[model samples]
Target: MKILLLTPQFPYPPHQGTTLRNFNLIKGLARRHRLRLFSLLAPGDAPAGTPVTDLVEHLVTAEQPRRSMARRLRDLVSTPLPDMALRLWDPRNFDTLLEHCRAHPPDVLQIEAIEMAPYLFGLLAAGVRPPRIVYDAHNAETLLQRRAFLADVRRPRRWVGAVYSAIQTLKLRRYERRLLRSVDAAAAVSEADAAELRSMAPDLPLAIVPNGVDLSAYDPRHPYPNPYGRSGPNLVFTGKMDFRPNVDAALWFADRVLPLLHASNLGPHFWIVGKSPHPRLRRLRNRPDITITGAVPDIQPYLAHADLFVAPLLAGGGTRLKILEAMAMQKPVVSTRLGADGFPVQDGVQLALADTPARFAARCLELLQHPERAAELARRGHAFVTAHYGWEKIIPGLETLYSSNDTLTGASDRR
Candidate 1:
């Protein structure tokens, strides 16, 4: 079948979570379907490797919009939609998507994330009829924004973060609901998000196509004994540093959890690895024990070298791709329930789940001190992902959605 995949960003290089997920899915589906990827890439942020054009039928890159004051004012007043204010204002992206659809009318058009839904929905209204409309619900953007708003409760300065987030949340929720009603099928990384989408539209054709990793590229043995490991025992937290949830998680761990572990005779080093280290994260850099590597070329080494993988994320949407990747790398992960969503692995057998600071720190300490138990947990986690969350296992189900003509039960039986 001929398929068109619309993405918010260039999926090559695979540095960020969304990019990695899209890249893996495209690579997997390209093996079976005639795929054409139309991605909106930010100006000057060229992906390191060749574009998706070589592997697929076609690849179109659209310039993203700049967040200027004029844009903000226009967005607040005259925008038809929230995402339109943020992204669709760029006429080039709209033209690019429409042009591609006209040039090659695909059997299925898979909107990869919430951000791209605006363009896809707009194109559909403009009479772009692709029989199969698969909304790849990466995350419930509304819920994510809601969480962000809630997390800002303690701010005394009274920033407009909450108000802005709420506005975006409401706007996106409406857009998502409309898309759910209009689209042939929808898929999310987590059942929780699928449930949320279903709540918006009772009969929304929804499925759970999870975020995935390339197993071959992220082998544990390949990146073991990393350069960053020579210091004390490393406890690593990996994600986009500027992300609010990740920032909150890292701070929660450092301020609330680390002290408890420190008191318990666990003198562990902390490595927070990701791009765009926020100011809050910079504060932790003063301590000799904490090192913030702002955007390394590769993260596998950091994961392999670390004694433990820590994901204390308390607020966010969608499954934690970092948690899954750590599990796939056979690392003992200590995370909150929120951090380990969607992947149904036993807490004690595959990973350690602790919501509170004391319990979270204790879990990390337990995994660090007890090598046998940690190894067993890591082994079990890897085994679980190998069976359930592998790209090979999940992609066939997605392929069925794209290929199957039935609207009511779009390849649900195969799972």
Candidate 2:
């Protein structure tokens, strides 16, 4: 099959969740199909000579459109579309897709995330005979926004952000329903996410295609350099620090959980590892116990060297690729239930799970003090992800979706 993939960003480095999913899906799909990728490049993102270039038959990129805050505010007041629908709206990208469809229509047009839904909308609005469109819901946007609203509403200081999310949640529901109904097939990263999407369009044909890791790249046996100099039982959380959920998670863990660990005299150093530390997080640099590495070339070293991986995410949708990466590295993990939302592992089987700050800290302390138990959990986690959460295991479901005659005809009839 010839597939045309649309992504919000170039998925080469795959450092972040969105890019990781897109990159792995492309790599897996390319094994049996011809792929042409159309991606919007973020500032400073370069695709030349990247491994992704080799995976696709052809690749095209356009600068991601810059939307001013004023424009976003204006849209919030005047438009029914969610913020995401307008985030990547660019005429050039629409024109590029149209032109390609006219000259070399693909067998399937696989839209990577909600941010890229504008192009699918554009193609349909233009009355072009689109190929079988596959909407890959990275997160059920409505559900994600709902979770954000719930998380932010309790804090008086964040009421403004809460209001924004509350409004976006409604807007996303309507927008997502239309997009799902229009697509030939849809995919969600997990059963939990798929359930949320199903609530929007009950009859929509959906498949579960969870996020996965490249096992070889995250091998526990690799000789990754110890990035934490002068560390005593380093606890690491990795993500794009600028991301709201990550920012929230890092702050929550540092403020509420780390102090508890300290009070117990466990004295574990916390490392926030990723690119683009938020201003709120950057302020923590003054603290001697916390080391905020702004950006690292590779995250494997951080994961490999960590004594424990902590995910204290309070508000986020989708299964965390960071957790999977950590597990693939054979490191013990302690996460909030929300952080481990979509995975099927038991609380003590794969990794420890806790909700409250004290419990979270206790779990970390327990794992830190018991090397044998930690190693057991780490081994189980490694085996669990290796058996289930690999690109090779996840990609076949997507391929099956693409090849299903019922999915193709059923979607075309709806249109």
Which has the greatest lDDT?
A: 2
What is candidate 1's CA lDDT for residue 70?
A: 78
Instruction: Find the 10 residues in a row with the least total lDDT in model 2.
Output: 406-415
State every prediction's TM-score relative to the real structure.
0.92, 0.96
lDDT of 2 by residue, 185-270 (tens): 88887777888988887877777777889998999998988888875789999999998999999999999999899876767899
* Candidate 1 residue-wise lDDT, 1-415, digit = tens: 8989988888877887888889888888888889898887765557445656666878777777667767776786576477432653466678878887998999999988877777876797799879888888788777777777776655644357767777777887877778788788878777778778888988665667777777887787783557584665789999889988999899888888988888867688888999999897878999877789998888888888778999999779998889878988899999998888766766798899999888898788888889999999999988876766678777876765664553433222434
Off by over 4 Å in 2: 407-415
Model 2 lDDT, residue 397, Cα: 75
User: Each prediction's Cα lDDT score?
Assistant: 0.79, 0.88
The candidate scoring highest on TM-score is 2
Runs with alpha carbons beyond 4 Å of true place in candidate 1 = 47-51, 73-80, 83-85, 154-160, 223-225, 403-415
